[model samples]
Structure formats: C-alpha cells, structure tokens
Target chain A: MTKRVFKAAFVSSLPVLMGYSAMGMAAGILLAGTVKLKFLPFWAFLSSGINISGALQFIMVNWTEALLPLTQVALLTFCLNVRYAMYGFSLIEKFRPLPWLKRGYLIWSLTDETYALEVDSAARTPAGENQLDFCLGVAFLDHLYWLIGVTAGAVIGAALPFDSRGIDFAMTALFLVVLTDQCQSKINRLSAAVGIISAICGRVFFSTSNMLIPAMVMMGAVFIIFRGKFERKPEQKEGEE
Target chain B: MSRETYFLCMTLTAGVVTIALRAFPFLMFSGNRPVPPVIRYIGKVLPPAAIAMLIVYCYCSAYQDKSFASGGFGLPELAASVLVVALQFWKRNPLLSIISGTILYMVIVQNFV
Candidate 1:
C-alpha cells in the first residue's frame, strides 16, 4: 500500500518537481550572481533560517550583505509565513490521526505548496491512500529541486558569468504557475486578492518589504472574518466502504 | 564560516525538518476518526489566498527601490508580467508561463532590463 501510494504521489508531483527544479536553478543563479557565497557558508545561511524560519533563509545572504534592516526583514518574513498558522490549524486533523513520530515528520515538510496539494487533495478526495503521501511527495521533490538549485548556484556563483537579471524572476515564475493550478476556485482568488491589497497597502505605508507580516495579519483577519461569505458547499464524498 | 560547521547546521536544520515534514501525513492518519470542524474549515481557504498573496507580493515588491524610466517598471518586468498573465490565461500552466516569462526576460534584457 505504501509503495503504491508513493507511486501515485510521485506521478502527481512530477510537474511541480520540474517547476521547482527550474525555479531552484533560477534561485541558485541569482543567489550566486547577486551575492558572493561559499558552499558551506551558503548551507549555513540556509540552515540558520531553516532553524526558526524557512522563508527567511532564502533572504539571508541578501539580508546580511545588503545592509537591509533586520527588523523589517523579520517582519516581512513573518507576514509571508503567517499563512503557516492557518495551515497549522487545518493540519490538526491530519496530524491528530498520526502517531507522535509521524506527526513530527509531517510538521517539518509543511510548506505552502505541500500544504496546498495535501489539503486540496484530501478535501477533494478524502480517505484511502493517505494525503500525507502527496504532501511529502510534493514537498520532498520540491526540496530536492531547491537543494539541487541552491547547491549549484553556490557552485556556479563561484565559476559562471550568468545573467543576474534573468535569474531574479524565478520566484515570480513559480507563483504564476501556482495561481494557474487554481483557476477553478473563486474563494482562492478572493483570498489572494485580499493578500495583494494588504501587501500593497502595507508597502505604501511601510515602504519596506519587512511589513509583509502586518499585511499578512490584516489579510488573514479579513479571510477569517469574511470566510462565511466565500464558503463553499461541503464537497468531499470519498469514504471507505 | 568553516565548511564543515556550515554543512552541519544546514543538515540539522533544513535536512531534519525536511525529513520530518515529508514523512508526517503518511505516518499519521493511517486509520481515521471524525475530523474536527476547524481543521476542515482552515483546509478549505488557505491555498488560493496563500498563492494569490505570494504572487502579488512578489510582483509589487519587485519595484520597491528601483526605477523604470516612465513610472518605474523596467521593460523586462512589464513584459514578463504580460507574458505571465497571457500564458497563465491561455496555457493554464504555471510552470510554462513563468519559465517562458523568464526566458522572455532573459531574451529582452539585451535591449531592455
């Protein structure tokens, strides 16, 4: 059963894995191009952020060398990740079903994309073949993609003469892809719209990327408060016989 | 930092976290019980909101301290944005849209930025 489910997840995540690998490459190129980093130092930077914050790791090299404000950086990161709390809330059911060891593992791989695939899949098709397989599959492949890219970026940064401008758009491209996958849903569009408005408003007022949290908070509140307006009819019909 | 020390930190931090999160769901919920209401609720709205916000923020912030000649969108970003929208609309594949957009940006940078 485990092996068969793993195959399903692997097949499902192939597209995401491809995207992640390419984007990771772009990220690597940018990290290396825009900044100087040695291999160990690079991983250390990734680790430092991973310990407390995964999003922040991506920015560590820039934040450290760019003379960006620490407070602002932290705020933006927190706001960007504020969705994690929401994701966490949703995960209680999935985790509550698991034992301690497994629950601990699931908590580790719960990034935005992983969470989306799992929640969407589970909600769309509940029961039989754990949703965790999909989450791990997506998260695992994406991580590999990132690891490969970041490691390469560190290596290439040392040797190559790649164009820095082309690489910076990686994240932009990744987000664009994610949005495409959700064209069927209206609630998602509404949620995204709220977050965008909050981000813009926060930017205008704060004029710094660091204010992402405040914007996230504002947005998250709006989502929860108005969730009823956008609520969908319960649709999950899958159950074991 | 020393290479060995740096690698150790990342292995412990990212590596361990990766292993845990990846393994989580499969291990738990092998059998089932009634899922609480809140969990069901949160699971519903997160993805769209999260993805939408991420994309918007990435685009909006890309122009923060930078200049764009007229109103401040360097040609490449503007072009890429258009391509992103059109590709996403027409192709409906996020990966294709962004990757193509990146390629476009790379191509146009010769004349633009």
Candidate 2:
C-alpha cells in the first residue's frame, strides 16, 4: 500500500519536479554569479534546503551580497511570504491529528506547490490508501528536487566561462507573472494599484535600498483606511472558492 | 562580522521566521478560536500588493545607474517586461514566458546596447 501511494504521489509531482528544478537553477545561478561568496554551492544548498521558498531564494541573493540589516531582511521576508500564514488555516484540522514530528515536517514544507498537491491528493485519495504517507511522499520528493536543482545550478554557474549579465531579470519576470495572475480579481487589482503608487512614492522619497519598508507601510495604511473597499463581501468570497 | 558568519546568521533568521509564519495558523487557531476578519482580509489582499511593489522595485533597481539617454534609454527593460506579461497572459506557461523574455533581454543588452 505504501509503495502504491508513493508511486501515485511521484506521478502527481512530476510537474513540480520540472518547475522547481528549472526555477531553482535560475535562482542558484543568480546567487553564484552575483554574490561574492566562497564555496558557492554549499551556500546554495543551505539556503535552498532551509527556506524552500521560490521568491525568497531569489531575493536572498541580493540580501547576502548587500549585507542588508537583519531587521530589514526579516521584514522583507515576511512581506514576500505572508501568504504562507493563511495556508495553514485550511490545513489545521487535517494536520491536528498527526503526530508531532509528522505535523511539524508537513508545516515546515508547506510551500505553495506542496500545499496545493497535498490538498488535491487528500480530496482524491483512494480508499485503503494512507493520506499521511502520500503527503509525506510528495513533500520529500519535492524537497529533493529543489535541493538538486539549486546545487547543480551553483556548480554549473561557478564553472561557466560566459558572462551571465542580465540574468537577475528572472526575478523581475517572476514577480510580474505572479502579479498578472493575481490581478484577475477586482480586489487584488485595487490592492496592486495601491502597491505600485506606494512603491513609486517610496522610490522618490527614499533610496532604492530603503524603499521597501516605506512602501509596505503605505500599503498597510491604505488597506486599513479603506478596508471596506478592499475586503471581499461574503458572497464574493464564496464565489472565489 | 565575517562574511561567512553574517551569511549564516541571515540564513538562520530567515529560516526561523519562515517556519514561524507557516506554523502560526495551526498554533493560534487550533482550539476553535475564529480567525479575525482583519487578519483574513490582510492575508487575502497583501500578496497582490506586495508582488506589485516588488515589480516596481525591480524596475527601479535595473535602471538605477543608467539614465534615460543611456542603456538603450530603458527600452530593453520596458520591452522585455511587456513581452513577459503578454506571453504569460497568453500562454499561461511561466517557463516559456520567462525563458523567452530573458533571452530577448539578454540578446538586446549584450549585442545592441
């Protein structure tokens, strides 16, 4: 039974394998070519293994090279990944009955891709198949793919003879893709406009290195001051799901 | 601090914060306490706003050192970004969109500029 579940999980995770490996290689290459760190592959492996976050993995290359203050790093990390906090709400009941170790691993590895697969697998789980085992199988395989992609990219990047100029644009492209997807909703569009205006204002008033916090502050203020406009109505929220 | 130690500290800080945030909902609302509406609203709206803010920041950083008269007058950045958004919107394939857009930007900057 366990073997069968693992096989099913592997089949479902093939798409993630491609996505993570390609994306991870981009991030790892950026880290190696941009940052001046020695033992580049080791750092790549460490950051990828620990964070397992797509955006943060890319952004951290900049943070390390610039040696940004810890407070700023923490805040930026939170702003970029705050969505993970809400992912747990849907998973709370399902994970409550799990053992401490198993639950902890699941929570730790609750990336956007992994979370989506877990939820889908649960809904479609065949009877007599253990859901927890399937979840674990998916989580472990995804984690391994990310690790391999990043480390391999670092190795290749360090050995490359050609210039890697303009590769950092991958991060910008990623952000644009995500924003385009999000803007499909009315509420998201309003919030994104506020964010763009706030960031432009921040760039005008503050240095590029110091703009993010101010932008975040302005964004939060706008969201609060106009909560009624931004918050979804109950019926609209239901429709979204 | 040495660079190695600084990197380590930063990694640890980021890792701990990430794990804590992921664990938040489970730790707080496990026992039947309803999530606050304000918190829920922020969670829903923050991702789009934050992502948009980052896109602006990327543009600012890419052109920070170059003026409008130089580096193809920011044309590469603008053109490539448009291509990315358009391809992503049309194909809905992230890898295709990013790879094609980045390659175009690279060729323009490396050869034309």
Candidate 3:
C-alpha cells in the first residue's frame, strides 16, 4: 500500500510539477519586472497562490496596483474562489472523512490544471485510497513546482534589466498549453466552447468584478441542461491500468 | 466610490457568495434526493462551458470587441490558434497544440510582429 501510494502520487503529480513551474516562472517575471514590484510583495503573492492558484493571483497583482483595502481583498479572494465551492460539491463525498487540516490544502490547491489532473486520475481509479493518494500527489507536486517557479521568476526578474515587454505572455502560454493538452475528447472541445461563450457573454453583460459569477452560473446551467448528451458513458472500469 | 472601497465591496461580496456557494450545494444535496435532475444535468457540462468562457474572456474584452483587432491580422496569433486547432484536431494532443500555438503567437508577437 505504501509503495502503491508513492507510485500513484509520483505519476499523478508529474504533469503538475512541469506545468506550474513554467507558469509560476512567467508570473514572477511579470510581477517583478514589468510591474517593478519588490520581492517581499512577490513572495507574499506566491505563497498565497498555494491556496487559490493561477487566475486569482494574476488579478490580485493588478488589484494590488490599485491598492484596494484589505477587506476588499479578502472579499474578492473569497468570491473568486466560488468555482471551488462548486467543485467542492463534486468532492464532498470523496473527502468528507478527512480532517480540515488535511483537507485544507487538498481543497485549496485546486488550480485549474490541478483539478483537471486529479479529476482525470480519480476517474481512472476506484473511489478509495488510490484516488485520494493520486489527488494528494498531484497537489503536492503542483505546489512544489509553483513555489520553485515563483522563486525562479523572482530571481530572474531581479536580474534582468530590460523592459521585458512580453513576460506576461507566460501565463497566457501556460494556459494555452495546459488547455491544449487536455482537449482530447469531444467533451473537452464542447466544454472549451461553452466556457468561452459564457465568459464572453458574461463580460459583455456584466462588470469585470461580477463577470465570473454569471459565467459560472451560466456554465452550470448549460451543463445541467445537457449532462445526458455531454459525453459518452465511461466504457472501461477503473483499475484497468 | 473610491477604488479601495469598490474593491472592498467586491471582496466582501466575493467571500460571502463563495462560502454560500460552497456550503449550500452540499447541504442541499446532503440527503441525496437524487441530485435534482436539473442540477445533475447542469453538472454534466458546466465544466466545459465554464472553461470555454474563461478562454474567450482571455482573448476578448468586456465590450465584445476582438482584442487583437487593434494589431490587425497577426500571423503569429493566426499561426498559434490554427496550430492549436489543427494539432488538437488531428494529432489530438491537446497539450502540444496549445503549446505550439501559444508559443508561436507569443514569440511572433514579442519580436517580429
């Protein structure tokens, strides 16, 4: 069991380790260089990212420029995490047994990439230790990469003196990369379409601050409306691997 | 409102709404009354739609205008998007296509275009 857990953890975490590191690197570069932010603030942002991951941090960096009040920050941070609230529903049955301390990172480390990985791996394994182990491994691995990338980006940002006009592209690139890698099925394609459409509509109709909620709600509505036809039934049993 | 106050309001609203979203769904479904057909249905495709909306959000603005329009027909962006689509469709490697296309666009835009 110990060996199995280790194996599951390592294999599941491999992608996260690779992806987050690159993304974190890009983020660090932007915050430190283009924005000319200090290391302490950058560090603060990176560590906090362990909880919410990618998008929020990017927004936070911009918000910091605006220098909003702490209450606003906490509120927005909490609200930005609403999707996780949604994701949490799908996971309650799976993690209800764990203590919040153990579940804290487990729930908190759910970046977009991490969630995709854990969800896919969990679907491949039975709803037990193997699944849990895989999920934990992915989180641990992804988090490790993010920390390293943050440090690296900070260091590099400190070193480089040029304008570094294109540093922000790193996040965009990472997103495109992770998204492309995951889009193997018709379901993924449709999901991408739905996400894009809903976000565009949401943004057009709503303020930037409020766009995410409506986007999530609309996506949720669409999914509920078409769950039966969204994807084919799972053809294989778990543990086939 | 001042920027700080506006952000503060946004922050508070986000926190309350998020906690409610997270906590409410589970409590409502705790008894397992068959997942209300409507909810279960929504669950099926919400992830995709949500992700798609985010991507579109990344490219376009709140006004629904093409962000790239200011720059005109960008070869790199074109290359990257096309590469992502074609590679994803043919080789079906979502990662490869995304990387190639995004990188192509980033590189193309950064230096040449």
Candidate 4:
C-alpha cells in the first residue's frame, strides 16, 4: 500500500519535478555567483529545506549581501510569503485528522505547487489508499526534488567557468510564466492590472528598497475598495436569492 | 555582526516568519470554523495581483542595476520577456518557455550587449 501511494504521488509530482529543479538551479546559481560566501551549498540546503519558497529563494542573496536589518528581513519575508496563509484554508479539513508531525510537515512544505498537488491528490489516490498518506508522499517527494535541485545548482554554480551574468533572468522568466498563466482568467487580469499600476506608482513614489510594501498596501486597498466588482458569485445561491 | 552571524540571523528570521505565515490559517481556524468571507475573497484574488507585483518588481530591480544600458536601453529584457510570454501562449509548456527564454536572454546579453 505504501509503495502504491509513493508511486502515485511520484507520478503526480512529475511536472513539478521539472519546474522546481530548473527554477531552483537558477536561484542556487544566482546565489553562488552573487553572494561571496564559503560553504554556499550548505546555506542553500538549510534555507531551501526550511523555507521552500521560490521567490524568497531567489531574493535571499540581496538580503544577505546587504546584511539587511532583521526587521526588514522579517517584513520582506512576510510580504513575499503572505500568500501562503491562504493555502492552508482549503486544506484545513483534509489535514485536520493528521498527527502534529505529519500535519506540520505538510504545512511547512506547502509551496504553490505542493499545495496544488496535495489538494488534487485525493482524486489520484487509489480506491483504498489513504488520503493523508498520499498527500504526505507527494509533499516529501516535492521537498526532496527542491532540495536536490538547489544543492546541485549551488555545487555547479561554484565551479562554473563561464560568466554567469544575466543568469538571473531565470527569475524574471519564472514570474512572467506565472503571470501569463494567471492572466488567462478575466478576473485575474483585472487584479493583475491593478497590481501593475500600483507597483508602478510605488516605484515612482518610493525607492526600490522601499517600494514593495507600499505596493502591497496599495494592492490591498484597491482589492478591498473594488471587492464588490470582482468577487466570484458564490455558486448555488444566485438562483435562490 | 560578523558575516556568518548576520546570515544566520537572517535565515532564522526568514524561516520563522515564513513558517508562521504558512501556518496562520491552520492555527487560527482549526476548530472546523468556516473561513471568513473577507479572508476567502482575498485568498482567491490576491495571487494574480501579488504575482503581477513581483514581475514589476523584477523589472524594477533589473532597471536599477542598469542592465539596460548595455542592451540599447532594456531591449534584451523587453525582447526576452516578449518571447517568454509568446512561447508560453503558443506552446503552453513552462519548462520549455522558461529555459528557452532565459537562454535567449543570456545569449542576447552576453554576445549582443
């Protein structure tokens, strides 16, 4: 049964394997190149294993190289990961019966891809297989893939002979891919437009170092003020109402 | 602070904060309660906007570094991004799009400018 669960989980996570490893390598390489540090791969292992955040992984070099204030580091982490707070809402019931350790691991590894996979794993589970076990299997495999990718990239990054200039464009391409995928929906397009405008305004108003939080705040305000316009109609209630 | 200590502190802080955020809903709403409508609404809508903010942020960072100066004023970034979006639209394969776009960007910057 465990073997079946692992096989199913591995199959489901194959797509993520491709994405995480590629993107992780880019971030790791960027870190190795830009941050002048010994034992870089060790740090890569530690941070990636603990955090499991793609965007944060890419930007961490900036924080380290600048020796950013602890307060700023915490704030930026929150800003970068605040979206994570919502991922657990949908999974609360699914994970409710889990033991503390397993649940904690699932939450810790709840990256965007992992969350999507875990949520969808129920349908993929064999008829008699346990949901929690399947989810746990998926989570663990995804985590390992991410760790391997980042650590391997760090190792390769340290020894590469060629100039790695502009390799950071991988980060940009990642964001663009996500944005393009998200913009396929009409509602997301509206929200993305607001985000773009707000970010530009923040850029115009604040220095690059200070623009992110302001832009986030502006987005929140806009989202709230325009909530009535964009809220998806709760299904099954429109006709009765 | 020494460099090692500073990095250690940052790693700890970032790790803790990220864990806290990821665990927020589970800790707060573990009692079988329905998620608040406001929270639900934000959850559904925030991703695209946040991702959009991130893309702009990336562009701003690149601009700050003056990467455009070598590429005839940001031509490489502009062109590479167009290719990425176009390939994503056409092929719908993220791995191919990202790798090809990034490689294209590296070539443009390394050789052209």
Better of 2 and 4 by lDDT: 2
Q: What share of the true interface contacts does each candidate keep?
A: 0.39, 0.79, 0.31, 0.76
Query: Residue pairs in steric clash, candidate 2?
Result: none
What DockQ score does model 2 reach against the true complex? 0.80
TM-scores of all models?
0.65, 0.95, 0.62, 0.90
Per-residue accuracy of model 4 over A1-241 as CA lDDT, tens digit each: 3898889999999998988898888889988887877688998898899888888888787777667688878876876677899889889889989889989999999998999988997798988999889999989999998998898889899988678877778878887888899899999999899888988999999977677788888888887777777787743222111
Which residue pairs in candidate 4 have backbone atoms (N, alpha carbon, C) closer than 3 angstroms, thus clashing? Answer: none
Better of 2 and 3 by TM-score: 2
Alpha carbon deviation, residue A112, candidate 1 (Å):
7.6
Off by over 4 Å in 4: A66-68, A233-241
- The sequence of per-residue lDDT tens digits that candidate 3 reaches over residues A1-241 is 3566657677666766776666666666666764434444445344434343555544544554545455545544553454555566666677666667656667656666676776676554544556676677777777677777766776787787865643444444444554565566677778778777777778889765556667766666665555555647633222211
Sorted on DockQ, highest at the top, how do the candidates line up? 2, 4, 1, 3
Tens digits of per-residue lDDT, candidate 2, B8-109, equal 889888998899999999999997899987788889889998999988988887776777567788899889899999999999899888888888888888
DockQ of each: 0.33, 0.80, 0.31, 0.68
Per candidate, the number of residue pairs that clash is 12, 0, 24, 0
Q: How close to the true structure is residue A14 of candidate 3, measured as C-alpha lDDT?
A: 72
Q: First chain of model 4: TM-score?
A: 0.87
* Model 3 regions more than 4 Å off: A1-12, A33-36, A40-52, A55-96, A111-138, A173-241, B1-34, B61-70, B73-75, B88-99
The lDDT leader among the candidates is 2
Cα interface RMSD of each candidate: 5.4, 1.1, 5.5, 1.9
Top candidate (DockQ): 2
The residue-level lDDT of candidate 4 at A72 comes to 75
